[model samples]
Target: MATSVKSLSNKESKLIMAHMYVAFTALFVGATCGLLQTLERSGKFTLPAGIGYYQILTVHGVVLGLVLTTFFILGFMLAAQSKTTGGLNKTERTVAWIGFWLMLVGTLAAATMILLNEATVLFTFYAPLQAHVVFYLGLALVIVGTWFEGFVMFKRHARFRKENPGERTPLLSYMAVITMLMWQIASIGVAVTVLFQMVPWALGWVETIDVLLSRTLFWYFGHPLVYFWLLPAYMMWYAIMPKIIGGKIFSDSLARFTFILLLLFSIPVGFHHQLTEPGIDPFWKFIQVILTMVVVIPSMMTAFSMFATFEARGRELGAKGLFGWLKKMPWKDARFLAPFIGMLFFIPGGAGGIINASNQMNQVVHNTIWVTGHFHLTVASAVMLTFFGITYWLVPSITGRTFTKTMNKLGILQTILWTVGMLIMSTAMHWQGLLGGPRRSAYSEYVGNADTAAWGSYQIAQAVGGSILFLGMIVMIIIFVNLAFFAPKGKEEFPIAVVSNKAALPPKVFENWKLWIGVTLALILFAYTIPLIDIIQSAPPGAKGFKFW
Candidate 1:
């Protein structure tokens, strides 16, 4: 008898590839829109044939920020869970496919509206700036699809726990469950605003909408949406990065603890995003700001754990001095190098986040291009680069293809181009913001005002940087194509870190979903209940929708 290698079933592979295809398609289209936005913003190019600046901006933000991230994260979670928990059952697989199709249909509907220039509301889709009713309906469908996916994941994990009582849950699958739980809970805010508020108002069933309330509800989902993008990257960092670098996990219990902390802290801090808006009580804003700062502790814990993992592994290999271990890392491997660079970007990105969250400092940068630069550093660079790194091995593994050396070299070059481009673009945006450059507006001379005049050079620099980033994106798409179809037929490893023997086992409390969920709900209510009531009670009359596009 011949020994058999463990792998995802052919059915599972096809399901996973469906997601990959959609995600990469979104990447190409979104990146092209981004490049066009920068060129138009520079005042050097006009959007030909009535293609509006806000139109491309809307496509860029929605496609990349919402569509690509959601598809890739859910797909990656499914793959990880399947591998770690002995694969999804037939029902689970069927449910996953259903979810995928729903999301795809939703994406197509929304994209059609955008291309028709019927909805240029940007990614935030804030109120008083109404989109087509179909757009809101499409977005609702996307969220519903994600919920279905989350449901199956929860079911699969529950089945595994029942089948093998007393055994520790697999790390990747546990993390996936936690991520989906957070998603299920946090997404309710967006769904509520869309279903009840935006959809009704857009359909003209209501003459006016309460702008403040809609915005409040949105930021409720918006800030956590940041973490929704982040935790998956953290999963790769904590659970997968170690194996790529020839080491075991630093501490499984610590990883679980950090994730729990993220869950507890992520949802209630949206008020920090609303620091400038009036009507919310200052005391409540202050409270949320404190909570936001508290959330930083887990991030620092993650940073500490990463450093410890690297040091211990380096020491094991008999590296000499304090920094000698850095030399021991696999610098040439794109799988390791790409996400490692992402870690470096987060140092500045996280600092900028703290600045934005602070009640006092927020007054300095609020609504400025600095806010745009901050997220570009975060979601665009750190999270995006990490996702690309995951693709290096993941696409090949699912397709039963080898990650060849030529492709690896191309990936590293792509990472370098991305880093340089983002550095230039984000730096210029930050500096210009401090000089009072506005965000979300197209090129304007402001009647030759001196202040506006100062932003011109920076805009030019943005165009340059944006063009380079577009090139990098093309390179990434090429890598994706090779991995999916043309790479040699061989099995690539799905790297999952083993827990260190010296690490303590996680306490059962970590798995207590009810306890965590209860605390999360309490925090959200405590943070928002009073203020929400005040907003509703002492409200201005609602405003009618506007269509600037």
Candidate 2:
């Protein structure tokens, strides 16, 4: 899309608007799925035990995890890349509309297939239950829609770089390119499945395929896909965390490196998902585990650095005592309230995630609610929370409307409910998992084992907990809907353009090769996983296997 260097481009506005609509839509679907799951567990909802619930779960995951994220990030990068963006011409505007509509159609079609029992495979496509041809075809188109963004962003950056030769690229643009690269690579597996594997199978040309091969390919893409979901949230954190907490970012250099680190480490670490799966082996597991653990290094550095930045700002603001900086912080504006609560939710989730990422501890928690809890802590608590907050912060620029101050406050309140509710729900599931209630089951019907009855109360607790989560989701959707269609247009205190009012930096750092090389080396270890799992799953009970990382 051609954008003038003088004003905000149509692509950016569309992306922002699309982001809002998709984000709200996802919240709506995910919340509904959550309600059903809760109802099923409560033994209260009178729904049939069939494809509808499973498909709801499936669509919820696909929509929230894949569909909504792609649109949001694509829009964000496109909008952010223009050095001088003017309003789009009709052709460019039409492209934006096509991309958005393609994504929507794909999401809806995929949802329909999953709902109708045509695709019984879990959202992860854990293995074998194939969906209708339309499902994979629809999904392929969604990915294609996003690829259009790559074309637009690259051209825009090229134009900007040409005009400003020898200037370092902005960190935001650098991350955006890497995200595109990562997404392209990540999409290969899914693309192959759709175009080569699943599509043919659904067409009845192929009789069967390798389940292990397909599942392994899925994880290779799947785990990295989570980071794809996370990068935008991370960008927000690195960019906004300090501003919200009353500090400057500890180091722009560190944020740049962290983005690079994400690219380097995230792609190769997918094998860690296969540590217990049949497709991968022990050596690969060891290698993957090492990389997976190493990933924490940069991540921890980020946490420490962000905290230091907070302290620096706090001291400058005349705050005193160990945690007194938090006291002086503004607690009312949704922009501020959302992230504070998001960070509050992250500490425990990060801790639990460490357990899942561990080599040995994973055996205890794998395929159980512990794994579920760990992710809920990350996704529900951290990623989704930040997304919601940022949307609140960005709403005015995109919609030209201000949400009700009370509803905005209520949104903050919903975050509170979700925080407490997820804590209770996930903790209950974690405890139940230790008792061995299997994951991915329609219901946790533990038979006759002492551990089964032991977890009953915990399962019941989740019913209550999930109900609270659903309520929170309802409140959130209401808030977003009101803002989108009903909120009065107000003078935006900080328009989207003003959001990045800091002095312009050159855009040369984007071409840095060091970051690319580092990521490549770190990911090499992923190759070892499949061999490792095959060896270990066969070992007798109480046996340990050797490995090479």
**Strongest candidate by TM-score:** 1
- 1-549: candidate 1 lDDT, tens digit per residue: 322222588899888889999999999999999999889988999988999999999999999999999999999999999999999889999999999999999999999999999889999999778899999999999999999999989998998999999889999888888888888888898898898888888888787776887888888899988988998899999999999989999999999999999999999988999998998999999999999999899999999999888888898888879888899999999999999999999999999999999988889889888899999999999999999999999999888887899999999999999999999999988887776778787854432233555667789888899999999999999999999988888878999999999999999999999999999999999999999888877676554222211
RMSD of 1: 3.0
Candidate 1 at residue 432, lDDT?
Answer: 73
CA lDDT for candidate 1: 0.90
> What TM-score does candidate 1 get on C-alpha atoms?
0.96
Query: Candidate 1, which ten residues in sequence have the lowest lDDT sum?
Result: 540-549
- lDDT computed for candidate 2: 0.67
Top-lDDT structure, candidate number: 1
TM-score list, all predictions: 0.96, 0.86
* RMSD (Å) of each candidate, 1 decimal: 3.0, 6.1
lDDT of 2 by residue, 97-181 (tens): 6777777888888878887778766678653677889988888888777666665555555555666787655555656666776
